[model samples]
Target: MHPSFTRRHLLSASSAGFGMLALQGLFGAQSPLVTRRTHFPSKAKRVIFLFMQGGPSQVDTFDFKPALTKQHGKPVAKDSPTVFYQSPWAFKPRGQSGMLVSDLLPNIARHADDLCVINSMHTDHNAHPQAILQMNTGSFAFTRPSVGAWCVYGLGTENQNLPGFITINPEFSGGGPLKHGNAFLPAACGGTPIGHGGGGSATAPEKPLKGIELPFMKNARLKTEEQRRQLDLVQTLNRQKLAADGSNEALEGLITSAELAFNMQREMPDVMDVTKENAATQEMYGIGDGKPTDQIGRACLMARRFCEAGVRFVQVNHSFWDDHSDIFKGHPQHALETDQPVGALLTDLKQRGLLEDTLVLWGGEFGRPPLLNKNNGRDHNNVGFTMWMAGGGVKPGIRYGSTDETGARAEQDKVHLHDLHATMLHLLGLNHEQLTYRYAGRDFRLTDVYGEVKHGLIA
Candidate 1:
């Protein structure tokens, strides 16, 4: 191969398995993995990040503020800003623990006790994109590796069958791949974003959202036997190439990626086969059976499938929540789209014994500011927000930290984004400070410069 072509192949192959497949000329030198990796052996082999993007109004979601509702139509403080919007709906207690949740998310309310609600979350950046980056990648300006990417790096992957991290239906409204990118790490560590929204993308929900078809056994095109031979030949070639270039870490990486894709072709479809799910399971995830945007429902179900299949991390985006204008329309629809399936994924995983080590994160980049705006909507608040964690060493029926009485800022037992990232890494048996990638003669880490595990939240 020409020297330039060889260099391009390295980039193209670096993403899809460590490096194992032959070039098809379609993916065209782009990486299949963009999220970072974990730093060590992991208690949770996989993660399903159920991001309620656009900063859902916490008062209307899992973070209950009775004071807000009690003082609705009037400011709790005389100096209260004019921008805070009141929730249109009343929240009621749900589930055995009776955690207060708005009626808009009744499905989610059913799982309240199982949630480890962290109400004292705060970020340095408040805008959607910056806060999102801070939440996912641990930085607002610098392009650091995302939490998913860092996890993959720290722990490698449980299943080579799927990419280390995958995002379903990420969109501009939700801040796109910046919401999931793996910066400064190898290209192999980034998230593979699957779609634009609930639907409409070549690789997303409306179109075979489970995964790109594997290297062989196509539903169309090449037959099974032919496909097998192709994989076998490719493996043989890679083996010979490795023998010739022993200790060539870059080449070995390429071989790993392609080989993984070949093996996954056979395993992923079955693991992700919703068709095999009985009607009861389907009903639990809210897939089909007349639900609107069942596409979002399907994505959440696939996240469960991927985790069960041993994929390291999966993100299912429900971004439409930037309610700059309309809370009644925005928050409810967003709630309707994600609430049941997420609750179901948690329930199903627990039923299957997967919850013990499979960590699940829910909530958004930040939260709505407390004061009401003239437009009847809320602005972003990095001062205080809520995010929850379940399973993977998280305590059950627990509430960690607390906001000041008004719930406007993190005061007691606050969990910063870096601390949250560190705590997550710690649960996976990683020393967040030790898991560093050397770049530009400096050691880079996910929780750069600051982090401490919130041990109280650990199970």
Candidate 2:
């Protein structure tokens, strides 16, 4: 190789031009992960979003419809092929609040009083891909920053050593990386995915996140000091390039991300190691070898650790709840896989005093319809679904909205996807409308031009 020909030049000329572009911005005055001020005083300082990929049936889970039970297996109207199917699980009052919870999620039922169930969550799309995209990014037609990305962009993070946003066991399909992607937002704001995407089934009995490690985290050829010196040399070149180019947002973002990645090598190992927890703690999350709850248990426990370590946003994905053909078999399996870990997460957080200021959200992209198809399962329903929130600043032990008698539509106090996003931002002391980013000559926000904060959900 020629003495003048550098590795950077080789990378630039090769198919790895994109990788070189990411390295161009390797130095900045201040890290983007530095904590910043909020728009207002708020109790919630962080968020843990439990994404149930594919839609879960509201009627079978939290929303109990006695009318549907009474009129089960009946057609909607004269000559209608579709018939109303009642939930197989029985619903009974749980906790002091007497919130009706199904037998499918008996573990979560224990915390009914601490839950603020929203039975009227409706989204834009009925399809899985679009609905999932809309739920995560607030738009299905166009790509945009995810809710986690937006949170990091708005408030930065409390831990400069870690990435602001993290997603555990994220799905690759239904919008893929774009679900947790930064989009037009700064690259530093994108989520740092822990495990490989498109994991196994919920009941697969394998710990998917076990033994996961960040790629390119270690250098076999160089000592720590040697690597630092090499980084310093590259940073000098990056600074020179920035000086020549003046101001570039993309370049700046790359620089910030590169530095954060380097710092993460030191802190992430300890944070990701759930084994460090006591046996009792691990048992609480239902973590064990060959257990059905082990996969989601690891994800949820890691979410708490990430948040406790000051990560601005953490998402735990439990794919999938799309039970179209076998509702009795599929829904119960999914619930069994997640219910214990989810409930334990809330209990653990409260016990550790983290729940007071940590926001926890649970739901899916959309929900299954009340009416069953010929296959004896429900189809996708974007008209009305259910979601729940706990801790944070939400009013616990209350049901905010409701669907019709048949649980077909949101009859009152409907909370659209945009409104949910707005309320989440509001809880974190961010005004959704005010959190804007200028890209392609127009100002854009997570909520686009629509969203009203559901103050009723707030304490």
Candidate 3:
């Protein structure tokens, strides 16, 4: 079962990249284990959802708050409707568009041209865990099929050798697996987590994407053809059982899942390897090296690779943006960890001609308040938050929605998360109104009867 030393060396070394060519030559386009096909023509066949967990401070990050700086540490002109705490943080322009971003994100500032930042965004839940679920899945408290799951069910898979939905160690905090779980939907719709440490949403300086582990079954040295034969037998048996016994739906799903896993063993590692990348590319991704705070640089880099390999959806999360303690210490750390790499990913996609068909989204469940907390940090502000989208059918340099004087509320062009989701689905060419899943005798959808596509974001 031990891997050959040569194979091990290749697996560990990412720069050679010849492993992918080798795998393709040996297995063809189909899974070296099992290949799956897509259901429809797609404008955006893949997604990279950068989840800023713990609701980032929109006013401090992207949404400018000139008034907040003017009124810093002072009470509002009006009474405190929600809390006694007043607004916090200052904002200024970062990049050519003159779009304001905070001081925390210098690295991201370098690539501002590539980002499409949405100023006004919000959700129902203000709490961390519930809002995380609401953002990832569609509800506040319920365990439903995550967006990743729905895409898999709606479009099936373009590359069956790899998982249809891959979550590289999603946060386990508030929503945890709920952010990527497939509740009522088949288990197949749930995300295939690449690493074990991601559920924590930490940004330490280790391998940000090192925990990618395959099923124990894939640890062997058998020829891929041998596994394919075994899978074919299982698939045939399952088909007959479905035909004879009316339908063992779950078991049938298991059959498909198994075949998918077997195929993934031969393909997934190659996509994850970074050693084979040229030094310039590696520097761009910050894979082996980046500032301590921007630990998520590698995930951003890998997202591009997955999109290239035809993955339908990839959600990259860097959470704990909830800065209820110290905004000075908190905001900068998260930004440094993410900014440059995100910029690099967007640019790379554009250069590679993948941006036209790839959708990249950035944001959190909600945003922080302009008002200050006891420790100088801002609290969650679901009333008016922020999010942004790019590539796919998105209109470049377009701004949608606005916040009030203190950057405390959504004042103009209010775009809710549901609306954001609808617009994303619209860009992918699927009618949000038409894409529905029947559950509990009711038709359910990601938008959930409450969304209007933000036209300004469209190309």
Candidate 4:
């Protein structure tokens, strides 16, 4: 047998495997804090996404359809597939711009001039899991890095002591962590979740982030200085192993995670602590007001603090909007729970001067159909919906695009989910096409192979 064919020799000869490992290690070591330049001059410095988990009926909320109301309880034709159900709420022009807004969101309606309502927004899917996935990651059929992950990967983090991206009170269903996951990107780019927004309970249970406090320190077993010294030793040993192994992504992640945890222990607690705010500030968010607004208010307030601290992307999730029955009851409850907090977030951001550079996005996965479906409620409608954006370089007080006269489909200036993703990246100064990640021998992006920036939405 050739000497090189010996078991020991053959094992040593597998240098290509080692090379691949080393290459992975090199990529893994890429820091999430290394800021990169945008493709062009951009308007927004960061983004805050107020994600309404289930679909909210646009016709009942922002898109008022007089034609539909006129035809209420009437069939489109003798053979029409669905029955027409007009919205229960009243629509009135708000602000100086005379933007018509439904009374369902009175608090939000107060800031009509700050909103850029896109009534012709549509997506690829009609279901929650796929539609939500498509809305967050821009792909419903495949696992992909989320928009937040892409943002972190492209722009890097401003604060090394804190996570670049955060999702507050995210629910476990409808794509769950996948909606905030990094996928093929570096693990560090994934969002740090504050609390799981429970399964649309009347009150979402509050849980602190796991590992937010070091067990040893929490138990008083190790002092801060002592832990630092121990961490240094552990990191040193990991580095030595990395040198011997030629490269190890897991080891690199371990080292990075350890360092981040230590720093977070030192700094993150204060940022997460909403009690630090004054009574008036807390009251403004309805923190102790004993209403549905309290839960989302806390979340919105925390989001503001995170944004002020330079977090790149912060998503505050409000859920259970999938009202297939009792939308009259469901929509009102959701609006009451979210409207005040959302409106407060915008008002606070503007007051703190963060509004101009902080892009705020508010919408659900899709929207409800114009016609009634099961038990006097609307069905999932991906053909046309409504979404709104504020600040972040978008033209304010403008209503772009339109659904049909019956508010059933996008008939003018349709903005697909891909287009929304592209426009979001554009606002953040990233070219959706140019923001590419090499994975599985192919270059992938948030927008996949299709995206066009909605130029008219820009200021």
lDDT per residue, candidate 4, 1-459, as tens digits? 110111232224335455434433433243554566777887998999999988889999999999997778876568665589889899999999999999999999999999999999988899899999999999998999999998887887778888888998776337888999988776777888766421123634444333233233242678889988998999877777765675455665677777777887767777766778898887777665345677788789888998888789999988879988878888998898889889989999999999999999999999987887648788899999999999999999989999999898988999998999899989988888878876666778899999899999999
Please provide TM-scores, in order, for all candidate models, with all chains considered together.
Answer: 0.81, 0.91, 0.83, 0.89
Please report the candidate that would top TM-score against the real structure. Answer: 2
On residues 241-288, what C-alpha lDDT tens digit does candidate 1 reach at each position? Answer: 654443244554565566556666677668656767788887787766
Q: How many clashing pairs per prediction, in order?
A: 42, 1, 16, 1
In candidate 2, position 195 carries an lDDT of 73
Backbone clash pairs in model 2 (N, Cα, C under 3 Å; residues 3+ apart or in different chains), count: 1
Cα deviation of 116, candidate 3, in Å: 2.7
Task: Tell me the lDDT of model 2 at 168.
Answer: 84
Q: Provide the global lDDT of candidate 2 against the true structure.
A: 0.82
Summarize candidate 3's per-residue lDDT along 1-459 as a digit string, tens digits: 000111233233323444434433322232212323322344576688988788887777777766556666565445543333432334456567766666566656555655677887877889887888888887886667888887766665667677778886474235767789877655666788765321122444344444343456365766778878877898767655544443344664676678777777778877876555687886786555334433466667667777788787898877667788877777777776677778788778888999888888988898888777557677878989878877787766656788887777888988887888887777666666766665566767777878998878777
C-alpha lDDT score of every prediction, in listed order: 0.70, 0.82, 0.68, 0.81
**CA error at residue 128 for candidate 1, angstroms:** 1.5
